[model samples]
Target: MSGPPAAPVSGLRALPAPDDGWKMLLRKEVLRFWRVAFQTIAAPVLTAVLYLLIFGHVLEGRVQVYPGVGYVAFLVPGLVMMSVLQNAFANSASSLVQSKIMGNLVFQLLTPLSSWNWFVAYVGAAVARGLLVGLGVYLVTLLYAPPRAAAPLWVLAFALLGAGMMAVLGLLAGLWADKFDQMAMFQNFIVMPMTFLAGVFYSIHTLPGIWQALSHLNPFFYMIDGFRHGFFGASDVSPWLSLAVAGGSFALLSALALHLLKTGYKLRN
Candidate 1:
């Protein structure tokens, strides 16, 4: 005697594929920022514009990082890349911390999604927001002084790699931080200081010998330097070197973030 007949496959709804999990999470994360574009998107663009106007006006004639490139023109790419890195970091870091504080992260934990899904979804959303803000800054700054992209490919490459690296770093920060102040400390003391020192407003070559060497040690320097190279086709270091440093930093951070996610560090607690 057989048990009750098996349910008809056609009558039952199919479960979503594994890939769908990440996709749905990605969509949610993306919407989270897009819905608050006024704050997440517009505010950053305006801040970048203010930087351009203030610095470009004061230093336009006095400071020239690259020959034949005006100071305002030289400043545009740096500002754009800076916006990209900061916002990318903010997106994932804030999302994770907020979810944890509001007690919604458990909902995600209850899903069948793996650690990789969380990383991809969070990082992907970050990259989206970063690129969008970067694009906005670039466009608005163009109104001040148009920076040429002699190697547009380099601009695209470094933007993607830099944004990805920062996103992963932000994810790591998020996983480690139990509260908002910790995240703020990470950003304020670490991310913000590094970005400001990364040749955003001046060339490393102009620095004294010791400072120049110190600048070279900063990974954020490579990102801004390489991105500026795309504009002027000139840089303090070879773009190849910048690419290696940025790429390697990204890989290392990604591994650490994945390991933390797998262990559910601070997340499961």
Candidate 2:
């Protein structure tokens, strides 16, 4: 043999392949929303502002859900949380459904990334969008009627839990939906009705006994109610109970989403 196999190049030694698919996915997801900031973030914030102006003006002094708390003030946190939950879910669900429909998702499937990587990237993007939207709503609302935070931690806890729950649900919806119509059905019929009936603009205590019982069955109620507790230090239910409900719902949805991802339900199938 003339010589040992050529030595590795001096300045270009063999290197291991990089595992950066997760990074790429995350960057793409983030940039996807960032590039259209107005649509991803601003429009939602504006919609929230409109809700505040319209609702606050109309119901300002007429309604007082919590003792000594202005109606507008009482409404702000709930609205902020509501905006967060919806946008978070929308971000992931729309992205996944669009990618699948457009046949672009195949590129991702070709990567070496694991299913866990896919789950993390999508859910992370959704949570980021949700938090940003929630913060946007909060800052904008400060101009109209500032909210009080008796238990700031409780507020954050519920916000994070709600966002996490919705993000996972979005992922599941995206994976389960074969078309945009199905995703739309989920949002319009289920998410929309639940958010509206969750008492974001009012208190459940004012509802009829049967309605109150029904509201308790909605997990969204726990999220909004628990978040409200952070502001007013009071709620229709104990914050602990709210936390339990929100946390449990989040766990359930997350498990479902992860399962769908692992099984490649509508994705690879």
Candidate 3:
């Protein structure tokens, strides 16, 4: 009587909408790193603490980057920001490359998710991992020296911008790379060098004029400098300038990453 029982609904199911699709992918990515908390989260925190102990021991009372700020205190913020940047990049890049190598990336490709969905899910996961590692390092380093936040808003702003920038950069690296070795090269030759040269352990003001000029060229320098500014209310450059450079760099990288994803550059293959 009711049209033969509504034709016995089809066996096939509809694909998830963009909103729901991204949330599921994001949950999967978060769980991927959460399942290995020791390696993904704890390991980085330990490394930052080691850096603090070694550098803070040797440099404390010997050098002070800003007036009235101890070397250890100054070092804490740098370590936190460094951990944030590195872990963010590692999360997205490693996940993508590993999935590609394991032949599991095709599962993601088969989803009805759009490029925007992929970007938000992957970058969101990276940001989560990055902030978590940063917080862990900050809390642990407090045992050694507590860095005060003179401008808490600036600190939060730079931290978010820096994490977002590195996450997008990692997405680009993942897309361009085909194997682990290539990924290693990108990390070692590019990311590590930039972070180290970005005035993490020392201030650029101590460098020669030429070197200081070079330091200004590094975007990582702006990130760390701006973050350090939040603690001491002083920086090599204006915090607003750092905000502009960091914000602009993040935008450019995000646009490139989105373009690659939309075009299926290396992902479809």
Candidate 4:
């Protein structure tokens, strides 16, 4: 009472409370993968390199998909996109499903974190991982077959959009899956098939007319095709169409993921 309560004496000045919940979640997701760099980062890079070696040697001079481009050169962009897509999908899907199974997801809900924050955090982390893996594959592949870019901007755009699209799809897969088995089923049955069929190893133009049309129906094809165009300046479909498909797919999946989060589809109750 002597001096107006002496300004609330304390041992140390109180630190400002953290307000950016999304940033914390994003950081956590990033660190989660970074902590296991050997598994999450190095393993994929190694797998990609192996693909390059095995496929490059086998198809180097045999397959001439792009006009003047060697098969190995054509393969590099596809490998890069494949790594980006798979890793991006895996990052968000595994994180969410694992959190749900381990019963720690409820803790996140209890925080002031909003659904939008959740979306940003999960998708952003997935994109980061996907891009890193893609970059690793690209850099490593250059050693064996150095492919020059015709349109680097298109390469970057398709890479980002493709990764983002897969990330959003992963969010949906995570919410719908209750167990690890279901997640595995989703990956093996849906993701793996689509990716492999998306023309990672060959071009759609080499297929029959019916097959070529069907291949165009697969959104992953556009991503890979568009990405290849960036390198060779040619593709099965127009670059603009590829951009539209990839961009549109991302928007649609993002909306669905957001809806799931807002309604607490699987996370709550």
Candidate 5:
């Protein structure tokens, strides 16, 4: 006998139409934060503004960085980078953990989304959130002083690479963590410390020799330093070197993220 009646067609496609699934997932991830703009977007912008005002007011001439550049000018890139880094991590990590806790992760795992598709979707979404916040931070900071673009391409490069690296790392963290508290501990203890230490407020040159050397080891340093270079055309190190470090980290994190998703590590269990 013939099947009862043809079911209504739905937007979701099967494996053969992988693009549809990938796009849908990406859109879903974007809308997730867009829906909470006040919390996700507006709050970060406000925080960056406050930081620029407070720091710029207190340390205008007290802190001399890059010789001629004002302290306010130096602080903008760092705040933008900080916003990008934090939000990028938050987007993917929160999405995955929430899905897991709510028992909807199985639905995603059962989909036809390939590992690469998952990577692109989650990371793409995270990167979008990051760039959005970074741009917002930059614009907000500009109200205090002009945003001179010394090397626009380099600025774009760092923003994209830095955001992508964190996005992949977030995916990896999401794969490893079983609960929200565990992710919070990771963010608070590890991510926050690393970002803050990445030269958000002052030049690494101001630090003691040993601390300066230690800063060199932080990938976040490369991100902020390189981005600042895009603004002032100077940084603690060569922009090319920063590009290499950030680019390498992005590739490595992408590999790790894809591997976890492919193997269903901690996710399937």
Candidate 6:
């Protein structure tokens, strides 16, 4: 009898042609919110709109920020940025923590994809959601308080940078947190307080001297201040300094996120 034919090689099949796992993961993350547009997208937009309506009504005539810029108009960009930053972070941190809690993360860890791929997929998806949410808030707010673009480039730059920074921070939070409570603590205890104190509702200059100096220490203030400058052509500080702080924070968080993934700090566990 003829000997058995040679067995086919296995576990080394040219890596299956390097499938588009990253793209697929990205698409899946995008679709995750799209499928539930009401919760993920509409809710935030509506919330921001409500804030515009309530505060705009109360403060519109009573307060004025920059010369020639109405209070409502002044508030729009800050709200938009706030919504973007918060939701962008929520997207990634929630996704990661949920995956870990539900035991779905193991499926991701089992894949041949590298840490960089994971980083791109998750962060890209978070940024995309953030931009979409920011756009939505802007469009809705226009109905109540239309604002002129004093520096469109600044608007674009700060929006992208703020969203990216928060996205990276979300990644780090997700990697570090073992549960939703911990993530919530990160958001409520840290992110929320910082954003609220960042002059989202008022000018930092209006605060007392001590508060004004304290505001400078909060990086979120620079983000909001810089974004507001985009609408008024004026700000309390240099736009360049804001850019440096926001960009620097993003770089630091990004490096930390990559390092965590590479070292399998919490992700591998």
For model 1 the local lDDT of residue 250 reads 97
Using Cα atoms with residue i matched to residue i, what is each candidate's TM-score against the true structure?
0.93, 0.91, 0.93, 0.92, 0.93, 0.91
User: After TM-score superposition, what is the CA distance of residue 66 in candidate 2 from its true location, in Å?
Assistant: 1.0
Residues 22-67, model 6: lDDT tens digits: 7888888888878988999999999999988899988888897788
TM-score of 3: 0.93
Give candidate 4 misplaced runs (Cα > 4 Å). 1-18
Candidate 6's TM-score reads: 0.91
Note the clash tally of each candidate. Answer: 0, 0, 0, 0, 0, 0
Question: How would you encode candidate 4's per-residue C-alpha lDDT over 160-180 as one tens digit per residue?
Answer: 999999999998999999988
lDDT score of residue 57 within candidate 5: 99
lDDT of 5 by residue, 1-269 (tens): 78799865232222343447889999999999999999999999999899999999999988878878989988999999999999999999999988989999879877877777788899999999999999888887778888689999999999999999998889888888889999998899989999999999988988999999999999999999999999999999999999999999999888877767666677766
Where in model 6 is the C-alpha error above 4 Å?
Answer: 1-19
RMSD of every prediction: 5.8, 7.0, 5.9, 7.6, 5.3, 5.4
What are the lDDT figures for the candidates, one per model? 0.91, 0.88, 0.91, 0.89, 0.89, 0.87
Tens digit of per-residue lDDT, candidate 2, span 202-235: 8998999999999999999999999989988999
Score residue 236 of candidate 1 by CA lDDT. Answer: 90
Q: How displaced is residue 27 in candidate 5, in Å?
A: 0.5
Q: Which is the winner by lDDT between candidate 1 and candidate 2?
A: 1
Residue pairs clashing in model 6 are none
Q: Clashing residue pairs, candidate 3?
A: none
Overall local distance difference test of candidate 5:
0.89
lDDT of 3 by residue, 1-269 (tens): 44555443121123335459789999999999999999999999999999999988888999977888999999999999999999999999999999999999988877778778888899999999999999999999888886598999999999999999999999999999999999999999999999999999999989999999999999999999999999899998999999999999999999988878877788767
